[model samples]
Target: MKIGVVSDTHLSDRREIRLPQELLGGLSGVELILHAGDWISPRVAEELEKLAPVEGIAGNNDGMDIVSRFGYKKIVEAAGVRIGLIHGDGYGKTTERRAFDAFEGQDVQAIVFGHSHIPYLERKAGILLFNPGSPTDKRRQLLYSYGIMEIREGEITAVHHYYASWD
Candidate 1:
């Protein structure tokens, strides 16, 4: 199964800004999309659902409506693999550490998280850690980015897909 992962779309609070066309292009053909949150606008998920089925966790910047809708963490099972999802927003510990703690003792093979808008991929202790970064808000990063993950025969292959611009 091929999955598109994304996070930290800090769009406007009141006025809705359209998501990047390039993001949809990058996500094209994926069976599902996993959003790690900070999707400030509800429209973010709405727009993405047009491409494929969407699921997400809530972030620190997310309003109550969003928080209530998606909660703080999730576990997704697709094509015989389990993926844990979190926004990586808590008062203590590093983002990656927090992510690990969220699903401790769980049966997930991969954990997808975001809070720092920096792409990350690591394998530790039998789990794949992934952060898709922010396609709309790169902050100090040089380029906008997202991630793609493929699961085949009980193996996971994930890579960051960087773009020069989201427009």
Candidate 2:
């Protein structure tokens, strides 16, 4: 199965929010979409659902309505792999560690999180940690990025898809 992963889409009522065309194009053949959070509007999920089913958590920037619909964390099982999802927040100097700790006791093959608005993908202690970064808002990064995961049997391979411009 192919999955598209994204995060930190900080869209609000005050600003025009549109998914990056590169993101939508990259997700063309995906079967599922996982949003790590910071989706300020539920419409973001709605838009993504037009392409594929979306599973997401609420980020710190999300409002009460989003928090009520989707909490801060979730766990999903697909292709025999258990994936932990969280919109990591409140860890001063050890954000990655805190994200990993969020699913500590759980038997997860991977953990997906976003908060720093930085793209990250690493394997530690037999678990894959992935953060797709922000496709619409690249705070300090040079490029906008998202993630793609291919799962088969019990193994998973993930990669980042980056573009210099949203256009």
Candidate 3:
């Protein structure tokens, strides 16, 4: 299964970029899409759904309605692998580790989150934690980025795709 992962698209009318070509183009052949949050607008969600089936959670900037409708987190079993998704508030407190703790008693192979708008892929305490970064909103001179996860036979491998300046 191919999973398209994205986060922190802080889109608004004032924001110059909405979604980039890298992300829209990369959606090809994806079985499902995961948006870790900070979508900032409902239109973004609507557009994303057109690419593939989407599972999303609301970020801190998301209004109450979005949060109430979307929930703070999501967990699903796909391709025989259990995956956890969250928008990851509590930024400076090691949100990744805290997410693991939140699901401490649950069964999950990996947890995905986004809040700092920085892409990260690493294993902590034998559990995989990832952040796809902000596809539209780059922070601290970071490049725009997204991620893809290939799952087969219940195992998952992920790759981060960042937008080049030329693009």
Candidate 4:
């Protein structure tokens, strides 16, 4: 199964709050979509849903509505692989640390998170850590990015895809 992953899409950054073609166009061919949070508005997920099913958590920047819909953390299974998802917020020295700790004692092959708006993909202690970064709000990043997670016969393949602009 091929899954599209993204996070921290601060769509509210623009006055119109319209999604950029770069992002919408890029995530076109996936079976599922996972968002790690900080969507800022429910409209973000609503737009993504047009492409594929979306599952996500709520970030510190999200409002009550978003939290009510997705909560702060989640665990999902795809292709027989368990995946933990979080916003990478709350008490931890770094976003990565917070994300890593979120699923302690839980059985998960991968942890997907977002908060720092930095793209990351690595394997540590037999688990995959992936952050798709912010396609809308890049912060100091030179390029915007997102991620893809492919699972086949109990094997996981993860990667980050970078782009120059959101538009």
Residue 96 CA error for candidate 2 (Å)? Answer: 1.1
Tens-digit lDDT track of model 2 for 57-160: 99989998888888899898877888999988874556678789899889999999999889998998999999999988899999999999889888987999
lDDT per model vs. reference: 0.91, 0.90, 0.82, 0.89
Candidate 1's displacement at residue 165, Å, is 1.8
Candidate 1: tens digits of C-alpha lDDT, residues 93-159 = 9899999889999999999999999899998899999999999999999988999999999888799
lDDT (tens digit, per residue) of candidate 3 on 1-167: 99999988888645444567778988878989988888878678788888898888899898776687678888867798888888878744676666667677778898889888878899866667889887787878458889999898878888999886534
lDDT score of residue 47 within candidate 3:
83
Flag the better candidate by lDDT, 2 or 3: 2
Q: Which structure among the candidates has the greatest TM-score?
A: 2
lDDT at 112, model 2: 92
What ranges in model 1 sit over 4 Å off? none
Q: Over all chains combined, what TM-score does candidate 2 have?
A: 0.96
Candidates in descending lDDT order: 1, 2, 4, 3
Worst lDDT run of 10 residues, candidate 2, spans 90-99
Report the C-alpha displacement of residue 111, candidate 3, in angstroms: 0.2
Clashing pairs in 4: none
- Model 1 earns a TM-score of 0.95
| lDDT digits (tens) for residues 17-129 of candidate 4 | 67768777778999999999999989898889999999999999999999999999889999899999999987647888889988999999999999999998888899999
